[model samples]
Target: MQFVIDDVQKKNLTGKAVMNMSLGGSASQAVNRAIQALNNAGVVPVVAAGNENQDAGNTSPASAPNAITVGAIDARNDRKASFSNFGQSVDVFAPGVNILSVGITSNTATNTLSGTSMASPHVAGLAAYLMGLEGLNTVKAVTDRILALSDASGATVQQNTAGTTNRIANNGQL
Candidate 1:
C-alpha cells in the first residue's frame, strides 16, 4: 500500500489517482495511517466495507476515515447484501451480488461472484470516469460530484444502517 502511495507521490499524480482497496482485516492504525497518507496526496482511496456483516468500524482500511468506504448491495432489490459490513463507516452501497466480471483464467474468461470487493470497483470506476468526464481533478471535487449525482430515490437501500448513506453509485444517469 505504501509502495502505491509512494509511486503516486513520486510520479506527481496527486489529484488524478484513484485507488481500489478491496481487502481488509482487523483494524490497524498503521494501515489507516497509510490510507490517510494516500488521501493527503489527493488520491481517492475507495475501500471495501468488508464481508463480515458487522459494523465496518472494526475493519482496517475500511475504517480509515479518509477513504470512500463502500458497502455491498443486491442489484435486484437495492438492499444491503447479506454479507456486507455496515454502520457509519460505510459511505455508500453498490451492486455486489452475483456480478458478472472478467476472470484470470484466460483472455476470454468470465465469472460471476459477489462481495464488497466487487462493489468497491464500481464506485472507483465511477470516480475515475467522472474525473475525466466532468473535468473534476481534485479528490474533493470528484467526491462531491459523485454524491451529488447519486440516485438516492430509486437506489436507496432498504434497512440500511442508521448512519450509512442510502445512495448508490450513479454514473450521471438517473
Candidate 2:
C-alpha cells in the first residue's frame, strides 16, 4: 500500500482515486492495517472478493474494513458466478465472466478473463469517473456514491450479514 501511495503521489490530483487490487490472500492483521492506511490517505482500496466460492470474510484485503470488496457475476444473465466468493465481506459485484479486455501480452491484444479480479476494475474505473464528473472529492463520498448507485436487485445471493447483500456495480448512474 505504501508503494502504491508513493507512486500515485507523484501525480497531482485533488479528487479521490481508487486502488484496485485484483489479487488477494488469507486474512491478516498486517494486510488489514496496510489497507486502512491506504484508505486514510484518501484512496478507495478496491479488492477482489476471490474466486474460491467460499466466504470472503476469510480473505485478506477483501475482508479489510477499508476496502471495497468486489465479487463476480455473469452480466448476460445477471447471475452470480459459481466461483465467486460471497458473504458479508463483499461490497459489490460486476461483470466477470467472458469479459473482453486488453491482454497482458500486448497493447492491442484482447482476451477473455473471468474472476473477481476482472470485476474489481469495473468499480474502480467508475469511482474515478464519478469523482471527475460528479465532483466527489473524498474517498468516503465516492464510496458512498458507488454503493448508492449499485444494483442490489441483480443479486440472487445475499450476504451473510444482514443489510449488506452483494450489490452489482452500476456505472451508468453517475
Candidate 3:
C-alpha cells in the first residue's frame, strides 16, 4: 500500500488516485500500519469486507481505521449474498454476483466474478468519480462523499447485534 501511494505521490497523481485493495485477512500490526500510511499519504484504502459470512472486524484491512470495507449483494435480487461477510466493519454493500469486467488477458476480454472483491471495485470507482467531480483533495473527503451518497434503501445486509446498519452501494446516488 505504501509503495503504491509513494508511486502515485511521485507521479503527482495523488489527487487523482484512489487506492482500493480487495483482499485482507486476520488483523495485524503491519496491515494497520500500511493503512495508516496510505491515509497519511492522502490515499483512501478501500478493501473487501470478506466473503466468509463472518464478522469483517476480524479481517486486517477491514479492521483498519479509515479503511472503506465493502461487502457483497446479489444484483439479481438486490439482497445480501449469503456468503458475504458482515458486522460493524462493513462500510457498504455493492452488487457483486455476476458482475462483468475486464478479464486478465486483454482489454477486449471480459468475464464475471463474484464476492466482496467484486463489490469493492464498484464503490472504489464511484468514489473516484465523485472525487473528480467534487475536486476532493483528501482520502477523508472522497470517502465522505461516497458514504454520504450511499443508500439504505434496498439494503439486505444482516444487522449486527449492535443494531447498526451498513448501507448498500447506490450508483443512482451518483
Candidate 4:
C-alpha cells in the first residue's frame, strides 16, 4: 500500500500532507514508507495513536517515530479514555465524541464513539485550517503549531506504579 501511495505521491503536483489514519497490525512498514514519502515530498503524515488500552509502546504506526500520534479524549476532557493507549509516543489528544455523525442507527445524530482513530481526523482538519489561516508552507511548522495550540491543561501523564511497573519492568514476572 505504501509503495502504491508513494508512487502516486511522486506524481502529485499539488503537494499536500499525506495523512494515514489506519492503526494497529504490522503496518509499520507502510507508515515508514508514508513518512519517507511525506519527507521526500516535504509534507506531513499524521497518524492515530490507536484505541488499544495498552501502553503506547504496543500501538503500531502510532508508536512509529516522525508521524504525529493522536489520542482520544472524552467530553469533559479530564483523563485518557479507558480504551485510549497512553505513553510518551502519544503526540497529543483531541475531541473524539460525542460527535455528530452517521451512527449505527442509520440516523445522523449525536453518538459517542471513542478511539484515537476518531481523534486523528480532528487534528488533520485543524492542520488544514491552520495552513489556510496562517499561510503555512512547511509541514514541520504546521505540526509544531498544532502541538503548541493543543490544550495540555487536560492532558494526563501516566506514572509508573510499584507492582504494575515492577511486573512490566521485570519481564512480566510478579
Candidate 5:
C-alpha cells in the first residue's frame, strides 16, 4: 500500500490515477495512515469492504475513512451478497456475485468469481472514467461526483444491514 502511495507521490499522478485495493484485514492504523496519505496526494483510493459478513468498519482499508469502501451485491437482483460486509464504512455497492472476468490459464479463458473485491473494481473504474470525462482533478471532486451519481433508488439491496447506504455505483449509462 505504501509502495503504491509512494509511487503516486513520486510520479505526481494526482488527479490522474485511481487505486483499487481488493485486499484487507483487521483494522490497522498503518494502513489507514497510508490511505490518508494517498488521499492527501490527490489520488482516490477504492477498497473492498471484505467478505466477512460483518461490519466493514472493523476492517482495515475499508475502515480507513479516506477510502471509498465498496460492498457486494448480486447483479441478478441487486441483493446484498451473503458474504459481503456491511455498515457505514461501505460507501456503495456493486455487482460481485458470479462476475465473469479474464482467467490466468489462457488468453481466451474466463472465470466467474464472487466477492467485495470484485465489486470494488466497478467503482474504481467508474472513478477513472469520471476523472477523464468530467475533468475532475481532486479527490473531493471525484468522490462527491461518484456519490451524487450513485443509484440509491435502484439499489434496493435485500438484506442489507443497518448503517450502510442504499446507493449502488453507477456509470450514468441508461
Candidate 6:
C-alpha cells in the first residue's frame, strides 16, 4: 500500500488530505500508512470514526493516536447518528446530511449519503481552509486549532463508553 501511495503521490497531489473510504478490511494499517505519508508530505490526516455503532475504543484508525477521527451528527445536531462509532477516539462530530449539495459531480448537484464516512470531510475542509488563511503550516497546530474551536457540548453522546466520553471535555473548553 505504501508503494502504491508513493506512486500516486509522485504522480499527483501529494500534500492533500486523503480519506480511506473502503470498509470490511483491516483499515488501521492502511490508515497508519496514510498518516505516515501525510506526515512525510506535511499534510493533515482526517479519518472517519467508522459506522459500526460500537464504542470507538475498538475501531481502527479512528482508534489510532494522532489521527483526527470524526463522528457523524444529523441535521438536528442533537445526537450522534445511529451508525456513527463513538468512544474516546472520536475527536469531534460534524454534519453528515442525508443530502448534500456539491458542484463537483455537476454544476448543480445534490447527493444523498449517510455514515461517518460522509461526515469526516467537513472537518477536513475546515482544517484545510484554516490552514490556508492562518498559515498554520504544521499538522499539530492545525489539529489543535480545530479541537480548540469545536463545540464540546455534543461530546457526551450515550454511545460513547462511560469513562471514554468525558475525555473530550477534559481535552479543552468548548
| TM-score pick, better of 2 and 4 | 2
Model 3 lDDT per residue over 1-174, tens place = 768887988998766777878887897879988988888887878888888888888888887878888888887776778878877878778888888877989869999888889999888888888877878978888777776667534454443324434577774543
Best by lDDT: 5
Q: Rank candidates by lDDT, best first.
A: 5, 1, 2, 3, 6, 4
- Stretches of model 2 off by over 4 angstroms after superposition: 9-15, 151-164
The list of candidate 5 runs beyond 4 A from truth reads 151-154
Q: What would the per-residue lDDT of candidate 5 be over residues 108-144, giving only the tens digit for each residue?
A: 9999999998999999999999999999988889888
Consecutive 10-residue window with the lowest summed lDDT within model 4:
164-173
**lDDT (C-alpha) at residue 81 in model 2:** 80
Q: After best superposition, candidate 4 residue 18: deviation in angstroms?
A: 4.8
- How high is each candidate's TM-score? 0.93, 0.87, 0.86, 0.71, 0.94, 0.70
Alpha carbon lDDT at 19, candidate 6: 40
User: Model 3 compared with the native: what TM-score?
Assistant: 0.86
In the range 1-174, model 4's lDDT, one tens digit per residue, is 355456656767223554656466444666566566665565566677677666665656776667677766664643455676667767776655465545676665556566777777777777767777777757778767766555323334233211111101000111
lDDT to native, each model: 0.88, 0.81, 0.78, 0.59, 0.90, 0.64
Candidate 1 global CA lDDT score? 0.88
RMSD of each: 1.6, 2.9, 2.5, 8.9, 1.5, 4.9
* RMSD versus native structure for model 2: 2.9
| Candidate closest to the true structure, highest TM-score | 5
In model 2, state the lDDT of residue 149.
79
How many steric clashes between backbone atoms does each model show?
0, 0, 0, 0, 0, 1
Show pairs that collide, candidate 2: none
